[model samples]
Structure formats: structure tokens, C-alpha cells
Target chain A: MYKYNDFDEAFVRERVAQFRGQVERRIDGSLTEDEFKPLRLMNGLYLQLHAYMLRVAVPYGTLNSKQMDMLAHLAETYDKGYGHFTTRQNIQYNWPELRDVPDMLSDLADVEMHAIQTSGNTIRNVTADHFAGAAADEVADPRPVAELLRQWSTDHPEFQFLPRKFKLAVTGAAADRAVIKAHDIGIRILERDGVRGYEILVGGGLGRTPMIGKVLHDFLPEADLLPFIEATVSVWNRLGRRDNKYKARIKITVHEHGIEEIRRLVDERFAEIRPTFNGVDQEVLREIEAQFAAPEFRTDGVDDYDIAYADNPLFRSWADTNLSEHRADGYAIVSISIKKHGATPGDATADQMRVMADLARKYGHDELRISHEQNVILPHVHKSDLPALYLALRAADLATANIGLASDIIACPGMDYCALATARSIPVAQEIATRFDELKIEHDIGALKIKISGCINACGHHHVGHIGILGLDRAGVENYQITLGGDHTETAAVGERAGPGFSADDIVPAIERLVLGYMDLRDSADETFIETYRRLGAVPFKDILYPKEAANAA
Target chain B: MARAFTPKVITSNLLLSGDAVWFTANDTWSGDIAEAEFLTDEAHAELRLLEANAQTGVMVGAYLADAKLGDAGPVPTHFREDFRTRGPSNYAHGKQVETNV
Candidate 1:
């Protein structure tokens, strides 16, 4: 966990004070609703369906026990004893009185957290691999860079009011847990020929228009990162479309201008800003890096791991799914499944928060992370403590043992809460997860991600799910559109839309039919939903979903 | 369809020494409750807002009331609107941390 410096402390305090005054002025007739809306938005507040929703930034989804406790307190005291952990890894309090928000901000500041840029059109929270430091195969920790970006972007005068909200993500591992490819700027920490650097991927985003990022620079030297990023943002800032909100994101800019042109501009800007670095940025990065230095590992032998795996079927099953290859030899990166069967994905109660906090403090090395897939990670759990940790998690109902499986769906809080949502997403996700679990088909399916978005904002990353469900509001009726073969990985691609949108009543059944179609079409049991879908294409699945002869034939 | 006009907290900003008490209600604070103007036309909305502001006084939460102070005059933490407006205070329970002071 990175502790806040004096700068962070003062910044949060000042922001809280500033927002407090703004609230007062609004009350005093000095500010109109329009005037106050943006001000509140800048602080990560939104006026949702029934009440005001306050989204607190989790800062790349890293939190310590103390911060988790504070969140628990807020949920219990201010909210309805539960917090919705979003796909961006931020925690949202669905019901907070507008008046109580300032206090909420103040409480967050006390924990070295604030909700600035969790909303509004500016750069939102910088996300990264939840298993950053502890990943078995990572080149280096990505958080230091994520943190650096965090500090640089926080209240950056130039980018405060961009054309639309910008997003950035980073990953240390070759495996893409952070969904880096779906962000405006994705940085992968890399080392080539003895020197460390970053692989910069730019102009990738998901919304109404989804795109896979192009590699802007193969390997940018570590020192030139800030300048490189600054250049990219500046180029997009000046040239990005402002006429239409939908076309304003860097994705559209990259698309319209082409990757080579964007790269050339970014390089030009980087060169211009290179001389001004003054080594201070590097020093800051070095300082942050020291904070992320790998934890001490005991050299004790753990020869029993294989034997335990062979003996225990449940542990073997859990290891098969929940564990990731660690950068270390004896340890494994653990992604604890928060999405239990039939439950809303990415939601954890106050008690669950506490248990996770305790687990992070105890079995894990006080290192915890929230994945973009809406799961928690005990990144560097020792192979020896796995059984005990598993037991504890089972007791707490946090142990689902399904990480990338079908039941572990990524679902957004849809029409149930979001004012912008056209139809319900959560129930559809729930029913699908439940259906698969009841059929006991989850394990056989293997490594399928089903993501649901309430709307085209694509908050759930529905655009990149193996199975994507998009909810739409059709004349006061709820409808769902399905897309297939989208993946959120190294080979990221937005799913192709299935034929016609289904009614709310028809969606879950349609999904079941689609899955059955995939099962039948799969080459072998090893073929995942995505692999099968890619090989078969959407035609067969479309036929299954729209079974009527004319519709199927089309 | 009948839409009831309740004093909606349109905008909330914490001001002064970090007091979170005030929020705009019908373009003016009314201690979290203001008699709203029913709008059939633009003029009625404007008049109702003006009258409400006049009746409720300045955008002050309950703690700002002179009578509520009793022996202790004006404690920032003591105001509910202060809590609502400013958010939580330095004192844990919205109690005056130093009552003697």
C-alpha cells in the first residue's frame, strides 16, 4: 500500500474545503443547478435514478486495511450498508444526500482517498493489474507508474475539462488483467536488452464505438514516460473532436487521424517536452518504485504443494481457476472471486470488505488489489497458506473459486439504479450465472467472460466480453442486444452484435441458447466460448438465439 | 401525471471554515426544506422561489438558528445542515469538541 505524502494530504484537504464552499454558494442562490453540476461531477458525484450517488476513487483499486475499514464505516453510516465496486475499481455509494457529500469527501480525505475525476469528462481513475507487484510473470510493478500518472493527472490544469472523460490503464504482466487495451492510453511495463521501459498503447476505448489500441511506441524509455503521455494527451486535447461528445474521446481521434499520425504527433510533443524533465520526474518515479519493491520471501521449501494439489480435488479445482502464475517461484497470484453464483457481480458488503481487509493483513503481505473484472486479488499468497486462506474465504462467502469461468460475470449496476440505464443488466447476469451453476456446466465451459452493460456507455466492458449483453430502453420496455467473440485480453476485439435485440424476458433464455449453441459447435472440451465462437462465427449462435426459420436463415 | 414540488437540494457546496451545511434549494438554501413554487408558467416559479427565500432567511442549516444555540453560541459541528452541507466535521459526532472554549 502506498502511503499518502504531505502533498496528497494537503491536496485532498484543499479540495474538500473548496467543494464545501461550492455547496454553500449553491445553497445561497449564488450558483444555479447547471453551475453546480460540473463542480460536483469533478469530485466524483452523480445524480442517479432515485438519489445522489457518490463514487469514491479507489486509486487503481489498491487499498489497505485502514482504508477498507473507512469504506466500511461510510457504507454502514452514510450508505445502505453496501457499496457497489465498479468495473473501474471504484466504490460507489448509491444513496447519499447531496448535503452529506462534503462530509463524505472529508472522511475519504482522512483515509488519503478522494473521488476527484471519478466522473466528469476529464481523465478518470488510472487502473492497473490488481496483481501488479506479486504477479509471477511480471517484468516489474506497474503501480509506481500508475501512481505517477495519478499524481500528474490529479487536477492537471490543462486536462480538467476535456471533450469527454479519459481513462488510462497499465499492466506489468503479459497477461492482460487490467484490460489495458480498452483504455485511452495503456502502458505495459517492459524490459528489453537490460534497460526497463514502457510499451505505450494508445487510443483504445469502449463505448458506442469500441477499439483495440495501436502500439504507439514499441518501447519508450522509462525516463521519457511522463513526456510521452503528456504529448499524447496534448495532441488529443488540441485535435480531438469537440463538435460531438461521442466523437470526442482519443479513440475516435486515433481512428480518424490514424495511429502513425498520432504517433508522429506524440513523438514531436515528447521531443519538445523532453528537455524540461529536469530529472525530477525520474526521481519521483524512483521514490515511488522504492515503495513498491518486492516483499521479502522466505527461502523455505514448499514441496507439499503438488501433493496437496493431487490429494484435494476442491483445492485443485480452485488452483486451476483462481490462481495465476506468479513472478515468484514458490508463490502464486490469487484472484479471489467476489462473484458468487447468482449474485450481482462486483458487489461486496461492508462485512466482506472487512474480511478481505483482514485477509490482506494476515495471510497476504498486506497487499490487496481490486481487478477491473470486479474481483479482489491476494496477489502474493504463499502456496502453504492457500488452504487456510481458502477456508477463511469459504467461511466469509468470498471463496467462489471461479476467476475467469463463465459464472464470474462482469455486470454493471443497470436500470436497477443508474438513471442513464435503459434496461436492467444485473438480473440478466444473475440469471445466467445461476443457470450455468445449476446445470454444472461452468467448469466444462472454461475461461468464458460474460459482461453486461446497462447502456452503450459500456461501463461493464460488454463490448469485450466473450458473451456481451447490452440493455436498452425501448419505449418504456427493457430490451437486450447480445454480442459475441469480444475479448478483453492481449488479442482484444469488440464482439460482433448478434442479430436482433431481445426483450428483457427473452434475454437470459437467449443467452442460455447461445451457450448451448457454443457447446454444440465447440471443437473439443478445451475450446473456450471465445475460441469456439471465433471459429464458428456469430451465424450459428444467431440461429440458436433467433430460432424462427426466416430469422435464423438470415 | 402530477409532479410534486419538494425542495430538492439542487447543489451543495461546503463553505467558510469547511462547514458543509448549505445547499441550494430552489436556487436558495432553506434548511433542507423550502416551500417550492408550482410552475405552470415561468413567472410563478420565479415568484415562488423568491418568496421561499424570503421566508426561510439565508442559506443556513439548523445550527445557524440563534434560539438553538442556548448557552453555547454557534457551534459549527452542532448543525445538521452543517453535517449535510459541509459533510462530517473535525469533531467525530457533530458535537462541539471544545464546549468550554
Candidate 2:
């Protein structure tokens, strides 16, 4: 984890003090609600449906055990003994009072973390693959570049308050766990002839309109990243729509004005901006790179791991489901499943937070990464420690053996807490997960992602789910519309909408029918739902979704 | 053709607490929508919204939501308003927590 320098520390402390004064002013009636709303939003505070919600950024989704403890402390002290981790890999306190926000911000600053740019029209959190450093396959850790982007974008005078919020994501692995293709700007670290560089994709997002990014530059040298990205954003900032809020995102800009024209303008801007950089960012990158150097690994722990696997079936199941291959010989990347059966997808209680922190300190490398899929990743855990870690997680009820399976659903906080939501997504997700668990066919179903969003905003990344559910408020009733065949990988595509929407009561049953239908449609047990969908089109699945309509048509 | 007037209530989140609040007949905010002043007339609803918005210290995001008088008082006509009144469905939190059921 990157420690804050003096400059970083001062910047956060000053912002906290500024927000404290702003809160006082709003309370005293010196600032009107209209005036205060944007000010609060800039500081990651929102007046949600229930109480004020504060979104704290986990920069590139990497934080230390000490920072994790501070989050637990804040949740216990100010919130309802729990915190909701969002799809953006950020943690949200759903019930912080306005007066207590300043204190919470102060607490966050103490851990070298702050809520800066977690919301508002500025660039939100810069996210990276949770397995950035530890993945078995990678060009380099994307966090150093992600951290550089964070420092550059934080309080950038020129880019602040653009037409709309901008999102950037990076991935080191070719597997694309970060969902980089669905971001405004997606950077994939690539190496050519032993020299490292980036594959930059621009104008990809999922909201009212979902898009997979176009290759802005297939191979941009590592040195040109800052200037190149700056130019791209600058072009969008100058030309993007301010007339309609929906049409304001860079994706739409790239859509309306073809990528070719945008490319020309970016090139023009890059020429002007590149000279001004003069390798200062490269120097900064070198320092950041040094910080991310792999921690010391010991290759002597083969016997203990082998013995534990042989002895325990319960731990074996969890290990098989949640652990990933690390580059280091004796180490494995552990994914702590927060999506317990029938529980809210990404929420962790204060006690659970403390337990995860303790486990990270005990078995993990004192580092934690939040995955975009709403799970916590211990990027470096020795294979020998798997059994004890599995037991601790099982005791906490965090050991659900359903990663990349049907039961591991990604759902947004729908109408329940969000002012923007049209219908309830959480309950629907809960019901679906519980149903699949009851069936016990989750492992057989295999590698299916069910993402649910309350509305078209796609906060839950519903557009990219193998089975996507979008909850809409239709004529004062909760109606869920399902989409099929969306893929969120190196080769990403938006899911197609299935026929008519199902009622909230009918959604889980409809999903059950669809998944069961896919079981028969699949070519073999080895073929995943997505592979089956690709091999044979969505007609078979559509038949399952709208069986009555199909019968009527027949 | 003109749209018909529907029943409405002035609603917003409280400034300090950030909890959902409805405007009452006494010009005060109430946490419970049951105590809200339901307006049948469009002009009156606009006037109440303006009144609520002007009290900057008291409210945030003040606006009128569609409502109808029911056994519980001003019940929400739209699902969004109904959801806001009840809070999130995940856990018993917010007004759902307050109900203590």
C-alpha cells in the first residue's frame, strides 16, 4: 500500500477542515440547500432517501490493514455498525449525520484516505484489477498508473465540474477482472519487445446507454500515458454536451462524434500537452512503481497446504471457489466472498470488517483490495494458511463457495436507499441467490454472473451480466427487465434485452426458469451459459423468458 | 387537453439528520408521512413546496411528490415515493428500522 507523503497528508487535512466549515455554514442558514448540495456532493456526501450517505474512496481499491481498522472504527462510531461496499470498490456509510461527517472525514484522513471525488461531476475513483500485483499473468501492476491518475485528477482545476462524472479503470491482467471495457477510459498495461506501454480504450460506459470502448491507441508508450489521457479528457471536456444531462458523458460524445474525429482532436491536443509534461510524471511513476514492488515470498510451505487439502472438505470447497493463482510460487490470491447466501451483495458489518483486517494481518500480507464485483481480495496469501483462513471466514459466515457461480450476484442498492432508484434491486438479488442456494445446483450451473440494477444507470453493471436484471418502476409497479449474453471480459459486449418485463414477485421464478432452460440448451457441461448463448443465439433463452408469449405465437 | 390535478405532499430530506421528512400543516417537518399535509389542489401544493424550499436550514431537495389520503394518512401514489417513505428493503434500516416490526 502507498503511504501518503507530506503533500498528500496536507491536501486531505485541508479538505476536511474546509468541509467542516461548509457543514457549519449550511447548518447556520448561511448556505441554502441548493448552494450546499453540490458542496456536499464534491466531498462525497449525499442526502439519500433515509439519511446522509458518505462514499469513501478506496483508491485503486487498495488499502492497508490499518486503514481497514479505521473504516471499522468509523462504521462502529458513526454508522449503523455496518457499511455498504459499492460496485466501484468504494465503501459507503448509509447513515452518517451531517454534523458527524466532518469528524468521519477527519478519521479517514488519519488513514491517508479521504472521500475526495468519490462523487460529483469530477472523475470518480480510479479503479484497478484487485489482483493487480499478484496475478499469475500481467505486464505490470496497474495501481502505480492508477495512483498517478488519482493524484493528477484530484483537484485538477481545469477538469473539475465537467459535463458529467467520468470513470477510469485499469487492468494489468489479460483476463480483465476490473471490467476495464465498461469505463470512460480503460487502460490495459501491455509489453511490446520488452518495453512496457498501455492499450488505451476510450468512451466505454454503462448507464442509460451502454458501450464497449473503442481502441483510442492500441499501444501508447508508458511515458505518454499522462499527456495522452489528459488530451483525451480535454477533448471531451471541450466538446461534450451540456444541454442534456443524459447525453453529456464522454461515451455519448464519442458516439455522436465518431471516434475518428475524436482521435484527430485528441492527437491535436496531445501535441500541445505532451511537451509541457517533460517526463516529470515518469519520475513520479518510477517512485510509485518502487512502492508496489512484490513483498518477500518464501517457497518452503508445500507440505502444510497439501495436508490441509487432504484433511478438510469444507475448506477445500471454499479454497476451490474463492482462491486464485498468484504469480508467486507458494502464494495464492484469496477472494473473501461478501455475498453470503440471501445477504446483501457487498455489505460487511463492523465486526466482519475487523475480522477481515485481522485475517489479512495474520495470514495475508497486511493488504486488501476491493474487487469491482463487490468482494474483498487478499492478493497475497500463502497456500499453507488457506485452512485457518477458511475456518475464520466460515465462522464469520463470509465463506460462501459461490464465486463466478450463479449465486454470486452483483446488485446495486436500489430504491431502498438511493434517491435515483426506480424499484428494489437488493431484495430481488437476495431472493435469486437464496433460490439458487436452496437448489444446490450452483456449482453445476458454473461461471454465471447475475448483475441487477434498480434503474438504467447500471450502477450494478447489469449490462454486462451473463444474466442481467434491470428493475424499472412501470406504471407505479416494480417491473424487472432481464437481459441475456452480456460479457465483461477482454472481449466485452452489452447483454440483449429479453422480451417483456417480469413483475417483482415473478422475477426470481423467471430467473429460475431461464437458468434451468440454459442447462438444457448448453452443448455440454463444459460449455458456460455465455458460451452456449454465443454458440446458439438468445432465441432458446427468450423462449424460456417469455414462454406464454412463445406458445401464443406458436 | 390539460392534465387533472392529483393529490400531493411536500417532501424532502432533513438538513441535519438527512432522514426523509414530509411537510405538515403546522409548517413543521415530520419524519412520518402519516402526519403530512396532503394537498388536493395544485396551487396549494406549489405554495407549500416554495415554503419548504425557502427554509434552507430545515430541508434538502424539497419537492412535491404524488400522494393520496389513506388509512395511514398521506400514502404515496408512486412506487418511488412509497420506497422513500419506507427506506431500503435490504435490512430493517431507516423508517423500516423505526417501525420495529
Instruction: Give the Cα error of residue A90 in candidate 2, in Å.
Output: 0.5
Candidate 2, residues A319-381: lDDT per residue as tens digits? 888889999999999998889889999999999898899998988889898888899999999
TM per prediction:
0.84, 0.98
lDDT of 1 by residue, A78-148 (tens): 87677888899898987677668899999999889899999998888999888888876778888999999
Which regions of candidate 2 are displaced past 4 Å? Answer: B99-101
C-alpha-based local distance difference test score of model 2: 0.91
True contacts kept of 2: 0.98
RMSD over all Cα atoms, model 1: 9.1
Q: Which 10-residue window in model 1 chain A sums to the lowest lDDT?
A: A297-306
Query: Number of clashing pairs, model 1?
Result: 24
Leading candidate by lDDT? 2
